[model samples]
Target: MASVTENKPSNPWQVWRPGIDPAADALERVSVLINRHEHITAGYAFTLGESARRYAEQCSLGFLLGLEMVVREHGNQAAILGWRHAASTVPQPSKSQNEGEKDA
Candidate 1:
């Protein structure tokens, strides 16, 4: 007996994942982050057009390290991409973070 899944036509662009693919998930998340910010230039690796989870916006340096780590861990079978444009403005420290500076 053929199951419903067996009858579905496979799309070449769509990857067949058994359960959850963590590598692909991370890749997509990072990719979207870089894609969203027009002025944001950062390294991102992606396995597909979008993320399995999500994309977050944050400081550049931190994001750089994070993206590099994700790519290093999941670069296998991945399409590696990178960019660097120092036009982004650094975010100001939060109130809580600034409070600690006052103590100094």
Candidate 2:
């Protein structure tokens, strides 16, 4: 049988977001954002800037917005990897595929 493997952290995404560093993730996401749009508009700048500015002010929102932008600009795979990296800073509790499925 092929067992499913899942990564589960004791902390929620919000909790994970705070401890993780945002600079590298932000840069990577912002790079993708900059590449996607040839012409940068004020709104675009605002969205990107706001995401960074508010990250410290509002960790959850900033983290979510950053993830959303990355997913929008890149893809879900990138977002998934990004999330994994973000969560790497924290200690995660491992769960088997079957166990994770049951929880879901």
Candidate 3:
């Protein structure tokens, strides 16, 4: 039982949205924001920006955003899981850094 609990994978969806109630009320709100972002960025399909495209694709993978937010909110188990999922997105994170590429 201990091993089973220890092996449970951290999930980003399980992370609570700060200031938002983690209940049925938040789902549609989140979905609306997500859909709005998707619609607004759909024009990117026609744009010829390679770097922007790569950045968007990396964000699409999700772990980086989840990691950054959870890290910013102080800490969470999902943040730890994000690190485990981030090896492929190293160069990606370097670019996403707000301060500098120091962590790169």
Q: What is the TM-score of each candidate against the true structure?
A: 0.25, 0.27, 0.19
lDDT per residue for candidate 1 within 18-51, as digits (tens), equals 2364544445555554455443333333322123
Report the candidate with higher lDDT, 1 versus 2: 2
**Top-down TM-score ranking:** 2, 1, 3
Error of 2 at 47 (Å): 1.7
Backbone clash count, each prediction separately: 0, 0, 0
Q: lDDT score of model 2? A: 0.49
Residue 100, candidate 3: C-alpha displacement in angstroms: 31
Candidate 2 per-residue lDDT over residues 31-79, each given as its tens digit: 5455654555545544554443333233466666655566455433333
As a whole number from 0 to 100, the lDDT of residue 44 in candidate 1 is: 31
After superposing candidate 3 on the true structure, give the runs of residues whose Cα lies further than 4 Å from its correct spot: 1-3, 20-28, 32-104
Error of 2 at 25 (Å): 3.5
Better of 2 and 3 by TM-score: 2
Clashing pairs in 1: none
Candidate 3 local lDDT, 1-104, one digit each (tens):
37775688877557645334322222323333334434534233222122222233344446435434433343233323333344444464445575565655
